[model samples]
Target: MFDRFKERTPVRDSLTFLEPNPMRILILLFITIATYAFAKEKMFGNGSLPAFLKHFDTNSDDLIDEEERQAIRDLRAKLREKRRTSIDLDQDGEISENEVSMARAALREQIEQRRLQKFSSIAGEDDLISREEYTTIPGVRNLPDFIFDAVWRRLDTDESGYISPEEFLSRLLKH
Candidate 1:
């Protein structure tokens, strides 16, 4: 058995061109990185200021009007307020560093509890939900198949063919 292994080493070494060439590996790495960059650019919508200006410049006059500029400022303020609200879980208008994680966890827990309640209502006495059971649930059955499938699969995090109450609750809780 040892001799068989030893013989294969020489055979592998003799095939010099078949060996993984560093230059080829480097080229493949470069291609993979380039592909990733390209994909990310396409997948994430452009957020560049010029793109934003183009989008909001409705009149096509090559310049934004005072009203348009005000709209932009309002949009920026709204976004800022949204960020503050998200980080300030208690709605206290401020977010201290210590409260950051606690706030996040609190928000996630609240959302999870709501999801669990919904799942429990549909799960009946089984305490576990399969995809079919989920699709056939009265409130959910009305949803189109594609939409329901996507939501169900997302909740079935472990992909173990069922969604436990815990799994349903934590599916998108983020913590």
Candidate 2:
């Protein structure tokens, strides 16, 4: 038995037999990366026109009429005033460079704190925001579910059926 075992030749060369096909491995990697890149582009590319129109077209018309345009202008004015008030740290009418810097820091901190608070309230014990839970957000509650579903999809980048704190905060902060 021992003699027979010793006499047997090696089953091919170890290096050749164990080596993976480099071309196949490279092709697989390329395909995976290309698929991921294409998906990301499709999800985030210039597909926001529908959402924009839905938000501004208050009368449910596809086109934004003069009245709708004026509403948008008014909203913008209100937002500008709010931002100006926040930036003016000293409660003065004018914003100085120092005040701007201070306001920037303060705003960042406040935003972070508020985001965490909101996420905590929305996510609750599960620590994940489902579609229903997402809709419950203050400003979001007013929007129709169909309209906001697009926004939810974009925010849920992983497509995991729920929004994590990181995803919620990062996406909201971007806008």
Candidate 3:
């Protein structure tokens, strides 16, 4: 009878101990957080898409072409690496969820600022970007000559071959 009672005590103690294990709890927390993050990314496609669109729509046409997509991917990778290196407070090689969120937010802000600067420069004094004005931008000038005129032409709605500030903002910022 004493042996059986001792066995019962050990079994109950083991069960109680397992329930509050710190390592087990940590593993569970990590799994839950990771699952949530993966699902969120899959559903949302980069957290905030307005930021992505603003950055990737090089011609302000509200469409991301193959080249533009590749460019954006490259830019995103660079920005992520830069921010991770700077923001990883723990010095762990891996960035935490909070750190990644912070990096993404900063990246979004940078993209927005760059867009505003480029818009102001491209708009010039007239507040509208003429086809000629668009081509004058350094970035536009660097694009392949064949693709350059084509992209600008596509963005010039109404077949007017000119882009108004309203059109530019609407297309780029609409998301």
- Candidate with top TM-score is 2
lDDT ranking from best to worst? 2, 1, 3
Considering summed lDDT, which 10 consecutive residues are worst modelled in model 1? 44-53
Write the residue-wise lDDT of candidate 2 on 50-90 in tens digits.
Answer: 45447888777567789988997799789879988988878
lDDT of each: 0.76, 0.80, 0.73
Clashing pairs in 1: none
Better of 1 and 2 by TM-score: 2
Candidate 3 lDDT, tens digit per residue, 82-108? 866898968889779998788788887
Instruction: Show where candidate 2 strays beyond 4 Å.
Output: 1-99, 138-142
Better of 1 and 3 by lDDT: 1
Q: Which stretches of candidate 1 lie over 4 Å from their true place?
A: 1-69, 82-95, 124-127, 136-162, 170-175
Best by lDDT: 2
Local accuracy of candidate 1 as per-residue lDDT tens digits, 1-175: 5776656676677886667897668768977886676665546655433443677787877578898899877997898788778787677787888678887778778877787787788787888998777776677878887898798788887888889987765655554
Candidate 3 segments whose C-alpha is farther than 4 A from its true place: 1-94, 139-146, 157-160, 164-175
